[model samples]
Target: MSKRYGGKFSPEEGRPPQTPSERGSFRGARRTRAGGRVNLLFFAPLPLAARAFGSGPTELALNLTALGALLLAAWLTREGILAQEAYEARKIARRPAIPRKMFASLLTGLGLGVAGLATSGVSAAPLIYAVLGTALHGFAFGLDPLKDKGMEGVDSFQSDRVARVVDQAEGYLKAMTDAIKRAGDRQAEARLERLQSTVRDMLRTVEDDPRDLTAARKYLGVYLMGARDATIKFADLHARAPNPQARDKYLALLADLEQNFTAKTRALMADSTTDLDIEIEVLRDRLEREGVHLETRDLA
Candidate 1:
């Protein structure tokens, strides 16, 4: 066992060469707009809870109701911000149907109004609080996206298909990320994020051109599910007992998956370019046949 102390024991042996992507991409996750304000919203309703305990029965009921509404509003507001972030990130996405932020604003108003009602006792003050709170909430956080993004000139049905698959792929990635956290390894979490980013690129490619869905379906669906399951298993195993062998193997698996997904994404882009070329050629031929006489400059 004391023999060379090299090869597999050495850092350079099993480690792959630092790829440009790997070297450049081990950074942190993107910053989200859903952090500070949403977090504060969670704490903001605590005073209502405190007030609920010391008051009479009617006041206590009203305070409790207000607390529930305010907490729900906070939750909705956070979700809305995240949904908006996701919508903005993708090239093609349908509008969120529920408009969570707007609803959150209403709930904030209702909660404040109820809290005021408990103290103000049937006066104009409660209505004023409701209106002011609603306005402030709406002003602080804007409304949800009202229209479908990146849908112009694109076939509705095709875009829908792409959106559906991308959504499923995102769910799988989220699950993998959650499972990895149970292992409590920063390196593993970072590695998982890189893989998730790679998967998202392919997801974006499919979203950009729905035609690629046919080719990349299995990668996004079955392969993604398999990766998620593997991550879950590895995380569970690693959480039970720290194993260098298992960690290295899991990281290696991540590297392999990243490479394959990146290659597949590039291939999809290439196919899209070829399809564009074919379409251009067909158009040129049709124009020439119609005696349009597209010149060299026109072709360019």
Candidate 2:
């Protein structure tokens, strides 16, 4: 019998293990707010499926149409919640490209109205139900953020560049995430998520100061692409033959990449602080020249 290598590493060989607190810090830290009601929406329309199999063709048609519309509304609502969460997470973000939640509300009302019309036949109940359904859906999900945020005084051209680069980097991260899932190792998935978090820190830094995008371009583009490719290869190899050596190498690579990304983010922050200090000093000098004796007591 051949021995199959598992991806687990011995504590003596690998990097020092993370403390329980450190590991648990992120366990419940990140979750979307679109779960409970959104999931319920999926089941709520199941009864329509059975109704679609009615004896009358008109009844079947109406039920099938309502079912499709309701499912679409559920999908739109879930996507809108996710988009809103992403928007909120960023210090600077454009409004969502589509107002999915609002559209979902409209779709919900349309679905309900159609169902009511089919059952009640030209009654005021259908109109009342439509209005109530739209209102309730909107109330539950809320409206999409309608305006760009934290974009004042920032060059639109520079911001656009940063957005484009960040979007590309996100695609790379998504690929890595999808590929790693194929490996079926929970630890590896967790490790990849940690590395992704580090990368996102750098992304957020760049987004806050578009000027940093030029300096950090290589890290965001070339380095991240390489990491993504390596992840893809590792996932494939690990799935076929789970080699401990390969797993260790991959883990080490992730550690190095995380460290580099973290260091770069710190450097960018330091640069911003330096710029602020320079502006303050220039302002102080100008004030002194103008005979405005600003108190320096707080300089202690």
Candidate 3:
């Protein structure tokens, strides 16, 4: 018999089978309460286009400017909402340097005022519309985070370093994700995601204690960069030839990496716990030296 090289047809050929957990995981991934308001703001200015066309050249220019300002305000509002969410997600996060949402509200008022002026030149109507627009915009999208979070006693310099390193590590994760997609293997992508999740756990641990940034610098910087390069090479090779053995090896590497990251995070947490215990013990000893009596319940 002549040698033949062929495999059975698969409906899911070149695609990984979806797992139960993967279903609905992405349904609300990008959906946010603020997102709806952002959408509404974007659409609210659409009427200005028609109004601009019907008006005189001066009025048309004013309406168009108002439309442009409103669109910019909408963009800024969306960005501010996203920034606030990111800030809330982190255990230690700095407030946004610029208050984008507050500025957005101001821009909204300016836009409304300009539009009103275009419709009725220099009248009380413009002032009322401006005030109402500003108030409504402020209500719909809250102000940006105004204060630094979890940085009360922490060194600003060390926190900045942690932020920089974490940002770079995230870039590595993003690069890995992008590279793996070229391989056209959803299984590989899923594996990468699992590994990335473990990596993020370590990142959160480091962020919680800026001191850990020094210890984890090698893992976050050097090791992650190496992993990213390896992933790019593996993705290229896998795209050319889908080798099961190579896939298995890559997954094994991911398993090893995840194990190390989890261990490191646990170690950092342990160190923090130890420090806290020592501080508590020292405080108790100081109280005892001061001749303070403590009941067993109070000590406990």
Candidate 4:
């Protein structure tokens, strides 16, 4: 997946510093700064006018126009920015940012502005535009707490947990698959390596936390199913070789390896370590169907 702030995905390599929660926090701060900027944009000309010209009717009118422009800009910017930032951040941080309701104020502000513009009479056009601008100002600023107040704590905890477990699983699988590639059958080996890395990522998502456990596990289960299918396909290809004797030997070796693979996976699944148990169960089931038993090992 293409990460916005981070580079390409590498299962074993350390991620580009910022975690999902960190990204969220950064986004929140950016929003706050943006709100401040919007406020400044609205009032910017007033200071220039005040410093350059003493209070006067012309200056007052110009300041009002500038203020209205700022409000309109702020309102329009919030929705687009929120949507864009959320989309980019999703690639790296998969969680659904619970308390998604916090953005309601922004929607409310944007709605009021649109409604005011739509219903205003010709004579009231300027008044309606000014009201819309105010609404935009409110929307841009009203969601500050949702972005800041205790949000980072909740998001950070889950982000770090997911990252740590994901890093470990990916590292382990990468090492194992890299070793297998040196034994010949590079194509099959490459497929296995890729499958394992994919599985590692899915597992990390499922293993992240219990909040969005249902969705995470569903996707993770699919990845495991794919992995199992890949292994089975490899076995099938080995069965149709030119030499019957060589094919039989290859088939026997694969069977032994698959059996061992099952046991090893079962061991990993059996561990009661992570907060997401439902995902662990789903992963175990998918592997078991393919005759690969996963054992969960407890660390503490």
Candidate 5:
């Protein structure tokens, strides 16, 4: 099994793993506003499921159908909420292709309406329930983002390329995470998460300046693929026979990768800063040529 990380830059270098409060790993994490009510949605369909059994032929069918629809609606609603959260988290994102929440609302209404029919057969009550349920669902979960964000002044082609590459990179990180869990070593799992965090920092940097995509492609692609493959191999071998040498070697590989990724992210940010400085200088020159004279202090 892997020992606790004791790399040169690790804060836990001679210490044990710290709790989240001690390390502040989740210091700035945003509290999610999704899925709380969605949990209730799952439970709400239980009565219909209970009623599904021990009923006559017609009532049994209606109850079963209602239960299915309501459960499906709950699932769709949860997914829609998660999608919205992802959209909000990114600096650049496309609108979801499907309006899942709207469909969920309709399903919810249909389920409720069917339930009303099962209980109170052929009446305006069912229709009323359908309308009210749909309305309430709509009001509760709200709508999906209807337009792309952070695309203003950005080339569609470039943004799309970056998005695709980032998606692939994220997939690689996820695989590393999944593989690390198989080793069943908590410290190794924690180290993998920290490494993933470093990679994501690079991702965010590239997203901020799509021009960095060219330079970061290899880091996000080739290097990450190699890391993922190594992680899988290590996990498999470690699962079969635990070895200190192998585990330490894998940890060293993680440390090296983390350092390289961090350096690359810094270089990319430096390049962006240089570009901004150049732009400012050119604008000042243009203003001066236009006979808009200003003292150094005034410019400052």
Candidate 6:
């Protein structure tokens, strides 16, 4: 207290004035803080998102891998559907008929591909393709006029023996079993037993008549036709019943039988030795031109 003249406070009683360097440092600190805040707003999201997933590049790669797997699954499923349609067409025509069902399957596959592009998950594409394929297969099998002519239903006696020709050409017993199981019939067991008996008889007959390949072939055809018919009937029954396990068993059996018959037929036919004599072959060729096949070239 030295007496203050006009009420001006003394330096000791008031706050001290800032120095020039101190003022500059204070302003610099404020600017630095503002810049730091802007950087945080801009860059914080990137690190935060990265951390939420896992780590930076590793997390991104995992997401990409998952997306790729989904796409591949979808594509394969679509292709599988198309293949089933082709199979159905061949079965129905009792030969390689690749028109209506094939076209439909292709269209369905394309649609499934488009769906996969729009959707997520592996199941979406595969489930869509499988469902469509199965539906089409069932429809084709149901409508197939040649279903009865399958190796499981061929007659032993006939001049041309259409059944025998088919047995030697395009026999498929396993396919019939699959058809029967899919159809879901209660009588499948009974029909299967009958078919087995027929097959045993044919095998015995063929063994007894070893030199008669023609007769053996005929009996084989009858056996095959019986098996095919059983399968068709089984399918009909399964369609009514809806048994997944039974259907799977049928499908497996069908595949096995198809392989067996295919191998047998190839072995039998690979010789290229026709029973028809050259003269008979020439006559047969002429008859084919008229859309006919001779029962016996000389007899016809």
Give the number of the best model, judged by lDDT.
1
TM-score of each model, in listed order:
0.86, 0.87, 0.76, 0.23, 0.87, 0.24
Report the alpha-carbon TM-score of model 6 versus the true structure. 0.24
Error of 3 at 80 (Å): 0.8
Model 4, 136: alpha-carbon shift in Å?
A: 41
Which lDDT tens digits does candidate 4 get at residues 78-172? Answer: 54445445433332243334332224333333333333333342356645555565566455544322332112335656655454444444445
lDDT of 6 by residue, 146-222 (tens): 23222333333531243334334334544654564564454554344334433433343333333335734643666
Tell me how many clashing residue pairs each candidate has: 0, 0, 0, 13, 0, 23
Sorted by TM-score, highest first, which candidate order results?
5, 2, 1, 3, 6, 4
Looking at model 1, the pairs that clash are: none
What lDDT would each prediction earn against the true structure? 0.88, 0.85, 0.84, 0.44, 0.86, 0.44
lDDT of 5: 0.86
State the displacement of the C-alpha of residue 195, model 3, in Å, after optimal TM-score superposition: 2.0
Off by over 4 Å in 1: 1-20, 23-30, 295-297
List ranges where model 6 is wrong by over 4 Å: 1-220, 273-300
Clashes of 3: 0
How close is each model in CA RMSD to the real structure?
6.7, 7.5, 8.8, 20.5, 6.4, 36.0
Deviation in angstroms for 157 in model 5? 1.5
Better of 1 and 3 by TM-score: 1
Looking at model 1, report the run of 10 residues with the lowest lDDT sum.
20-29
Better of 2 and 5 by lDDT: 5
Give a tens-digit lDDT track for model 2, residues 1-300: 997564557445546776432352264357778898799999998898887786489888888888888999999999999989877877667789999999999999999998888788798988998899999999989999998765667876766677778778888999999999998988878888888887887888887888888889999899999999999999999999999999999989988988788888899999988887888788888989999877765331
> For model 5, how does the per-residue alpha-carbon lDDT over 68-101 read when each residue is reduced to its tens digit?
9999989988888888887787777777888899
What does the lDDT come to for candidate 6? 0.44
Off by over 4 Å in 4: 1-154, 197-201, 207-300
Encode model 1's per-residue lDDT on 1-300: one tens digit a residue: 577566777877788786545643344357899999789999988998888889899999999999999999999999999999998888888899899999999999999999999989899998999999899999999999998776566788888888888889989988998899999999988888888878887887887888899999999999999999999999999999989998999999998999999999999999999988888888899998998877766655
